[model samples]
Target: MAYCGNIRQEGCGKLERREKYRLFLYVLLIGSITALFICWMILIWEKIPGAIHIRAGIRQDLDLNVPVSGKLYKAPAETEDGAIPVTGMNAAVDAREAKTLSVDLAEPLTLYAEDIETYTMDLKLFGLIPFKTVNVQVINDKTLIPAGIPIGIYVKTEGILVIATGDFTGDDGQAKEPVGHLLKEGDYILKVNGREVEGKAAFMRQIEESNGEELVLTILREDQEFDLKVRPERNQDGEYKLGIWIRDNAQGVGTLTYLDENNSFGALGHGINDMDTATLMNLKNGSLYTTEIVSITKGENGTPGELTGVIDYKESNKMGTIEANTVEGIFGELNESAASHITTQAMPIGLKQEVDLGPAQILCSVGGAPQLYDVKITSVHLDHDNINRGIELQITDKTLLETTGGIVQGMSGSPIIQDGKLIGAVTHVLVQDPTRGFGIFIENMLIQ
Candidate 1:
């Protein structure tokens, strides 16, 4: 009986051991699966694609307004104060003879006249027919015209005087002692000493009477007003002179080379120049004009891109110029004269529905830097926005990318075509990773 009992006990122990082993196996299997899943997730996190980087350059034809020194006139007072009673104070020229009339401001405390009660001062030419009428206006009793009031005038001007004193350098790279700092291309002369000069003649007369003495000039820079003491120098002709030139006007146009799929239209792939000083023009008030894409000059390695075109003055009727370009390009309203067909079409604004990783094309002109060419979409990231993200495009169109380093300047706004649909506009190009770039979803641009 004892042997049988011992046998039963051993058998039960064996069964219990077998059950424990089975449970161990089940736990081992689950642990392995969980570990494998964690490893897979880590790999995916590392392999996920990044963002897209793009570089864009846009060009547009522009007509800039150059501000010239007009005249200082005594605007009349509107109220019962000591203010002068004046009228019309607008910049104007004789429509018939093209003569400029000058009016002097008899008062000193007034800055400018109010717009409501302005009058026109008639001037007699050769003491016969009035050649020009000056615009003059009155000021309110509370408001006072600052020390210097800009007067408007019309004259056949040549260049401007660039005055500089102190230790200055010349274009020849040589140092020379300056006379009084003369008028620069961008400086607006407001007054000479305390006397109010009306026109260039009066300015010249004041200088002649000063006899080469140090003169105080109130000039307007940016928006703030300041004063500078300039002493005129005697030239070889024994005439007192300020190194300045006068310019009449300027006119030019460029192509609408690029469009930010994210923004509407941009312009001036570059900046404007002051012909007199050969420097970038210091802009005050300027406007943009629309033009037809006449032609383009392709860019090469080391060379810059340029768009050549004629101004669409007729379209200019509908065109609007930009007020500022400091932000992401310049923004402006379109004119009714804009191409009805182009303006009527809907523009792409944000990310496209689905861009295929196959083939695409760009719309640009020959001689223009951004030439349309066939390229292969190597990969399309499902979601990405970084500079290294976005779509991966290969230069399958060897000729285009070769002539222009994959994507060149002034090609920022070129339309990207894929599967007979507009995808997005090129926004950036990776300098180090030239083969890769970024684009803004066409849908994103339309929002504005």
Candidate 2:
């Protein structure tokens, strides 16, 4: 009896030991799964991309176009207005019997911007889209503008001067010979004919006194002083002509677009163009001034827009004139003050190649009000030929799109950032679709 009891005890002990071992195995299995899940999550977090950050400046370019208004005419419904006009007969009908048939003209057609006279339309029938085509009578309205008024501002200067002389005829119908010596192109005329001239009037008087005589002129060419003798020719009006254009040193102020926090300073993201030649104007020197936004003129359906402001020269200080404008934008060295908070820490200059379709943001001071808003990087196009117009961006920020109608006139050069990297700078906005725009990659801007 004692032996049988001991066997039972041992058997029970063995069963308990087996149960404990099974429980330990189950716990080990669960722990391994949990650890594996945590490892996977850590890998994903590391793989997620980072954002590119950049300091960008704003630039405003003026676009002028005539604004015209028109009305909309809807197609006649089956139970409503007059019959629609149609050409050609039905296929089942005979060719000879094919006459004009009524058809609906539901689709809209547009009229040119110059054709419309006044804005009068039924909002119920036409909706908000501008009219493309409308009937109008052309009128010779002299009251629209004064008889002999100038349209654009004439830019005058008093800097470096260049004078040239050529054969010109006089009022007496005599062929004047090319008697004057040529003033080299790089000659910088200082005082004309030994008279210290300040403005255009004083120089003109000197030319008048010469009156077809060989006149001695002082000039600075290639930093060396020299004198050139040239004879003036008499025009039909008896005015002495030297056929030279002169310019005075220009001093003005403009807005600063951005500062390269990593590099210290940056300015306009694009080049300023010469109004006469419509080419990028080369700058000898210019000062950066602070500007206060007085007002903003919004862009309409078909009309271009502009930003009007006065330069605060007294309150502003000269940063520097633009040294060069590479494919990225504009670059200049700092001679005076560096941006206060600029740092030398190497920040990410985000390449467009790294951008992904996700949420992002843009910083801009529109209408003199600075604001930040939510936006989305809709689609990214890689390996594109034109990198300036490279990445396709959409304005997902509701408030931004509402106020500025996506991207406005002065918003160019706004920085586009995603995952803490500076991807690109805003270049242009699509007219028909305002939400869409082109951005030049930050890499391209950093080339120069």
Q: What tens-digit string does per-residue lDDT give for candidate 1 at 75-135?
A: 3433333322222343333344323333322222112333334334443333353333344
- Highest lDDT scorer: 2
Model 1 TM-score (2 dp):
0.38
Kindly give the number of clashing pairs for every candidate: 78, 23
State which candidate has the highest TM-score.
Answer: 2
TM-scores of the candidates in the order shown: 0.38, 0.46
Q: Give the backbone clash total of model 1.
A: 78
Worst 10 residues of 2 by lDDT: 143-152
